[model samples]
Target chain A: EAGVAQSPRYKIIEKRQSVAFWCNPISGHATLYWYQQILGQGPKLLIQFQNNGVVDDSQLPKDRFSAERLKGVDSTLKIQPAKLEDSAVYLCASSTGQVQETQYFGPGTRLLVL
Target chain B: AQSVTQPDIHITVSEGASLELRCNYSYGATPYLFWYVQSPGQGLQLLLKYFSGDTLVQGIKGFEAEFKRSQSSFNLRKPSVHWSDAAEYFCAVGGKTGANNLFFGTGTRLTVIP
Candidate 1:
């Protein structure tokens, strides 16, 4: 079976510019997630979506970051006015929507803000 | 609320040597524990998890983990490591409610010397 898919495996942007990342989850998976992994650190959950509805986004930087999973399958994470600190790998994952289910991840988009 | 700690930032082991990576966690209750591996330029892959019952759990890629409640730890182990085992390993704990957020430790990077 195919795993989660993400677009633009790498991206580069200047500070204060805007960038967006996309993810297409595994077919039939009901839960999707976005995470940020800074160098030498583990991936941190940015947001989670269960069938197009947000399940948790408390850690998300609402002022500069936003995510949406419309129609419950495809998701997009956007960062406006990017900062140097925002340079990291943005990972997308999907699961069966069951509580505490195993999550499958994508290759991730490596964003470098100069 | 919940957090994880990986004491060792990096470890080097000869190929075919036994390997152990430490993981410590702080939680209010029995946590949903997991181990994930991430290769360079790749996504995170599940290695194993411990929900309850058995303290020791077997996982893919000849990996295993033992949950020690007294120690508040779940450490990943491999009897014989291969060069392919060189990657960043993460230990995570899932919250109990409200989407059950997953908290990750700053991963342990493994290098296998042939």
Candidate 2:
């Protein structure tokens, strides 16, 4: 079966610029997530969506970051006025909604802010 | 708050040798644990996970992990390592709460020598 898919495997932008990342989850998957993985660190959960509704986004930077899963099959994460600290790999994952189900991940978009 | 800790930033092991990586977590209730492997430029793949019942869990690619409630640790192990096993390993924890969000560790990089 095909795994989660993401667009623009790599991106580069200047500080204060805006950037967006897209994710297409596995077929029939009910849950989707966005994570930020800094170099030499693990992926940090940025937001989660169950179908078209958000499940959790407490860690998301409300001032600069936003994400949406309008139709619930695909999602997009956006960062406006990017900062140097925002230079990290953004990973997308999907699961079947069970607590024990394994989450499938995408190659991720490596964002480099200058 | 839930958190995961991988004490070793990097480990190098000779092929055919045994391998072990340490992980610890802080949570008040029973936690869902997972081990994921990420090759360079690739997405994270699930190695194994532990929900409850058996403390020892077997995973793909001859990997296994044991959860110790007393020590609050979940360490990954392999009886014999292979060159292809070289990758970045991450440990993550999720609570039993309604949300399925995960908290990940900094990660451990594994290098296998021939």
Candidate 3:
């Protein structure tokens, strides 16, 4: 089976600019998640979706970061007014929905906010 | 709020040597724990997870983790290290509530020496 797919393997932009990353999850997977992985740190959950509806996004900086998973398939994450601290790898993953199922991940989009 | 901690920021192990990575979590109820590995420029891949029953859980790539409720620990282990195993590893804890939000650790970078 194909793994999760992410576009724009890398991106660089100056502060205050806007950037977006796209993701296509694994086939037949119901749960999709977006995570931000800063250098020297683990991936933090930015938002989670189940069939187009958001499950959780409490950690997201609503002032700048936003994400949407339309049609419950592919998803997009946007960062407006990007700051130096926004530099990180944006990862997308999907799971089979079984409580014990493992999550498959994409290659991720590494963003460098200057 | 739930949280996870990986005490080791980095670790080096010779190829074929045994390896162990420590993880600790803080949660009020039964936790769903997971270990993920990220290769350079890649997304985070699930290594394993622990929910309940049997304290030990097996995972992909010959990885396994043992969960100890008494100590609030879910440390990962490998019988032998391989060069291909070099990567960043993260430990995460998921809440059991209906939403099941995950909290991740800072991560541990593993270096495999020939």
Candidate 4:
């Protein structure tokens, strides 16, 4: 089976610029997630979606970050007015509905804000 | 609120040595725990997880984790470390409700000296 897929494995943008990343999850997964991993740190959940509806986004920077999974199969995370602190790897993952199911992750998009 | 803690930031050991990585979690209810490994230039891969029932869980790549409810810990271990095992490891706990969001620790970087 194919794993989660993400685009633009690497990205670089100037501070205050805008950037967007995309993810296509496993074919039948019902849950999707976005996470940020700063250098030398574990991934932090930014948002979660269950079938196109947001399940949690408490950690997302609503002021500058936005994400959507319109059709439930694909997602897009956007960051506007990016800051140097936003430089990190953005990872996308998907899982089946089973509460204990393991999550499958994508290669991630590495963003470097200069 | 739920959180995870990985006490060790980095560890180095000779190849073929036994390896242990510590993880601690804080949550009001029993947590669903997981250990994920990320190799350089790759996505996070599920090493193991503990939901309920058995405290010991086995996973791919000869990895295992033991969940200790009394200590609120889920530690990963391997009988013999391989050079390929050198990577970043993350400990995570999933919330009990509301989409089961995962809270992750800062991560541990392991180095296998050949």
State each model's CA lDDT, in order: 0.93, 0.94, 0.88, 0.92
Scoring the B chain of model 1 against the true B chain gives a TM-score of 0.97
Misplaced by over 4 Å in model 3 are A98-100
Range of the 10 consecutive residues with the lowest summed lDDT in candidate 3 chain B = B94-103
DockQ score of candidate 1?
Answer: 0.69
Docking class of 1: medium
In every candidate, how many clashes are there?
A: 0, 0, 0, 0
lDDT score at residue B106, model 3, on the 0-100 scale: 97
Q: Candidate 4: how close is chain B to the reference, as a TM-score?
A: 0.96
Model 1 score (lDDT): 0.93
lDDT-superior candidate, 1 or 4: 1
Model 3 lDDT at residue B20: 98
Judge candidate 1 at residue A106 and give its lDDT: 99
lDDT string for model 3 (A1-114, tens) is 789999989999999999999999998899998988888877788988887999889889999999998898999999998999999989888887666566778998999988
TM-score, B chain alone, candidates in order: 0.97, 0.96, 0.95, 0.96
Measured with C-alpha atoms, the lDDT of residue B105 in candidate 1 is 98
Candidate 4 lDDT by residue in tens digits, A1-114: 899999989999999999999999999999999999999888888999999999889999999999999999999999998999999999999998676778889999999999
- Per-residue lDDT of model 1, residues B1-114, tens digit only: 889999999999999999999999999998999999999999999999999899999999999999999999999999999999999999999887623578899999999999
Rank by DockQ (best first): 1, 2, 4, 3
Docking class of 2: medium
